[model samples]
Target: MAEVSAEARIEAPAEKVWAKLTDFSVYGEWNATHTSFPKGPPASLEVGGQFEENMKLMGFPAEVTWTVEDLADTRTLAIRGKGPMGVNVGTRYTLTADGDATTVRVDGEFTGAAVSLMAGKLKDSATAALNESLRKLAGLVT
Candidate 1:
């Protein structure tokens, strides 16, 4: 398995960060890996909700069918998905409010046979993507 994470301190409240984080309509605008939502974002963001996303990583395109694993308003969101070549993907977003600013962390995991072949490269690419995504997200909210 390959694991990656990135963190950023945004100059905005958790509520504002969470609003942009969960608002799937604008997800692709800041999410580096996101290409598009195949059927649009989930209608509602309850646990067990499902959505299809088209993504690109390391210059390769993939489609993932994701199931929401956890959710907490203005605090956390987690999802797991099945991706190309039997790879399993998991992502979690965490937010901690500190006065008027928010600290956001994104954690990711990749498993299955495919990951073993290029774990190092995947980790580098994913970590970079997460960092870039956070920067974009921060730009949007702050």
Candidate 2:
């Protein structure tokens, strides 16, 4: 199992940040690697909601059909994705309200055959990419 976590304090309310992040239909707006994608159907935050997300990762077409594993409004959102590579990845977003700013934490876990081989080399890159994305998102919201 390989895990990567990144946290950032966005100069926006927790609810506001959560709204923007959970808006899977518009992730391409602030997420650099996920750009050039179109909005999709309305997907809710819950324990069993399933949806498809198409984006670019490392210049490749990265698409995943994920299911919501857990959710807590303005605090946490967890999801799991399964694929041929046996990739079982999970993303957790935690929010903390600080006056008018919200500290958002985006954590991810990858467990499977593909990840086992290159876990060490990928961790730093994943963290950097996620942190960079959070910075971009902060700029978009604030």
Candidate lDDT (C-alpha), each: 0.97, 0.76
Scored by lDDT, the top model is 1
**Residues 93-126, candidate 2, lDDT per residue (tens digit)?**
7889999999988898878888888788657666
Give candidate 1 misplaced runs (Cα > 4 Å): none
Q: Of the candidates shown, which would achieve the greatest TM-score relative to the real structure?
A: 1
For residue 70, model 2's alpha carbon misses the true position, in angstroms, by: 1.3
TM-score attained by model 1: 0.99
Which ranges of candidate 2 are over 4 A from the true structure?
A: 33-39
- What's the lDDT for candidate 1? 0.97
Cα lDDT of model 1 by residue, 1-142, tens digit: 9999999999999999999998888999999999998887888898998999999999999999999999999999999999999999999999999999999999999999999999999999999999999999999999
Model 2 TM-score on a 0 to 1 scale: 0.86
List, in order, the clash count of every candidate structure. 0, 0
